[model samples]
Target: MNQENRAGQWSRARQVASPNQDARPHGEVSLLLLHAISLPPGQFSGDAIEALFTNRLDPNEHPFFAEIDHLRVSAHLLIRRDGECIQFVDSDQRAWHAGRSYWWDSALNAWRSKLNDFSVGIELEGDDCTPFTKAQYTSLVDAVGWLMARYPALTPQRITSHAKVAPLRKTDPGPAFDWAYFRQRLSQAAFKQ
Candidate 1:
């Protein structure tokens, strides 16, 4: 597995620094939230996702873009449809992926809020209707394996979907995301839960 440098960047991914990030609170990174997105609703393979994350999205390009152009949001990484990994925020920093979300921290025996303070977000280039590509899954497994090795607090159980964390406001990495298959692959990659 490739190691991230002191600056918190993973050696394997293409770095695309995002302004929509900040230092992680307490330098704590324990949760992994999976998300889904596709520009123009279901369309894929364009610069739109990158544009949005980088705060360079032109509002006039699409109606949807106009609606969300003002929102400042980004994930730590985006695993593209063909398995290409793009790192927008460093692995050790906090990306603004989870907004007003909550998680049950079993270690603390309490419910944790402000999930962005302690979570890493990985967005898959997909939608609720389309099945994620095999390539995407393979890359995701590799990235997750690398993340698990770096952060001891990031156990398999700590990884979850965005929908679970922000039920009222978000539903991503949705039905099209096959959790069973993903877990199977993670295990196959020797990532113990």
Candidate 2:
């Protein structure tokens, strides 16, 4: 099918699906996993990355998405460079973004064994080396607002970066992400919207 056809298959008011999802586990979605991505690492949105997730990436087209052209992965939502939000998984289902991770509950001194079990994963369209756009941040905050309102289980404290869990394996929602700006923006937007 064409890109428009595939994209239209899961278009909703707040998200678009990927036909790459399944049911979420039986439990509350308490955690929010933060992530970042770009088909060629620094490049912005394009049909190539979307095609990659839909198992349609061309191996010889670009060296960036070429290496992992065979891998299959999707997140619950993808915030584009312009702040557009795309959904690949439902809020009630698990998105296979996080693989082996933990959340800090320092009081308990033990890792939360099931971080991904009941979490909503959001992937931003950017990499560790790139600076995310202001529009992206606003759009991300808007999406987060929508999610928190939809799922009461999610709180500010529950939102976390992928790097927090897989320190050695990943570095997303990286240093350029500006956590403080997002937090403040989220807090402000939450009150107004």
Error of 1 at 113 (Å): 0.7
Q: Write the per-residue lDDT of candidate 1 for residues 65-165, one digit (tens) a residue.
A: 99999989999999999999999999888999999998989899999999999999999999999999999999999899888878899988999999998
lDDT of candidate 1 vs native? Answer: 0.92
Write down the TM-score of every candidate.
Answer: 0.96, 0.85
* Lowest-sum lDDT 10-residue window in model 2: 4-13
Best by lDDT: 1
- How much lDDT does each candidate structure score? 0.92, 0.76
- Report clash pairs, candidate 2: 24-93, 24-94
TM-score result, candidate 1? 0.96
lDDT accuracy of residue 63 in candidate 2? 81
Q: What is the lDDT of candidate 2?
A: 0.76
The count of backbone overlaps in candidate 2 is: 2
lDDT tens digits, residues 1-193, model 2?
A: 6542343223432454566566666757778989998877677867765776567888888886668876777788888887777777666776678877878765457678656577888888888878889988887887787678667878898899999988998899889899998999999987886
